[model samples]
Target: MDTLHIVCPACQTTNRVRNDQLGAHPDCGRCKQPLFQGRPVVLDEAAFERQRTRSELPLLVDFWAPWCGPCRMMAPAYEQAAALLEPHMRVAKLDTEQAQALAGRLNIRSIPTLALFVGGREVARQPGALTRADDIVRWARSQLATA
Candidate 1:
């Protein structure tokens, strides 16, 4: 069976999971934590780098600041999108306020930016808030399809 490398959200361990068992709710081999919690993992700079570089799965990151209204408003939709997308890909959130240097390095000039990363490099980016879960899913999938 085909397998993919997944980074555990809880402990940052890399796990090899069978493709067929993706929807089976796989657990991390080393950490014993559920691989997919059907929600976006809250990321610090170190965790973001670990997940982006170590996992074979594509990553979708939301760059937001706490004071941004659109970012706050879109959080619910992003969470729903995570529920629909996990096990196939990873979804994460990074607070610009919390990771200032990382955010500046990434050149995040705006709040509520969605960036899709494959093979540890950003492939596509969308700048703005998407209020609907369906829209977020569609946009991310479409970006992956093109990438």
Candidate 2:
């Protein structure tokens, strides 16, 4: 059985899960919560670092602001993508307004930017919030190819 280590955004706990169980709704070992719920998991700096460094799967990070209309619109698409990609990829969201330091460090000047990370390093970034879910999925798949 294939296993992947996923960092919990809520509790910062590392959970090992079967790769095949990702899309089937795997829960955290510590928190007992669904690993890939439709909502974006909030991550702080330390949690982000842990997830980026330890995860065996590719990560899709959505950098967004709560007040932005496009960001709000993209939320559902992101959630859908998460639900679809679960065990294959690690999906997360960061609120730009709250994660100011992270945003500054990443040089994100846009409201809704998406970054694909693999092995703790960024591979690709999507600027603007007008992108469709299919396009985002395709881009992520391409990044996975490079990793």
Q: Against the true structure, what is each candidate's TM-score?
A: 0.98, 0.85
The best candidate by TM-score is 1
After aligning candidate 1 to the native by TM-score, how far in Å is the CA of 56 from where it should be?
0.7
Off by over 4 Å in 1: none
* Residues 73-100 of candidate 1: C-alpha lDDT, one tens digit per residue: 9999999999999878899999999999
Model 2: worst 10 consecutive residues (lDDT sum): 35-44
User: Which pairs of residues clash in candidate 1, taking residues 3 or more apart in a chain or in different chains?
Assistant: none
Summed backbone clashes in each candidate are 0, 0
Query: Each prediction's Cα lDDT score?
Result: 0.96, 0.80
Candidate 2 C-alpha lDDT tens digits along 1-147: 878888766677888888777777777889887767665567767777888898777878999988999999988888777766666777888888887998999999997898989888999888887446677777788878876
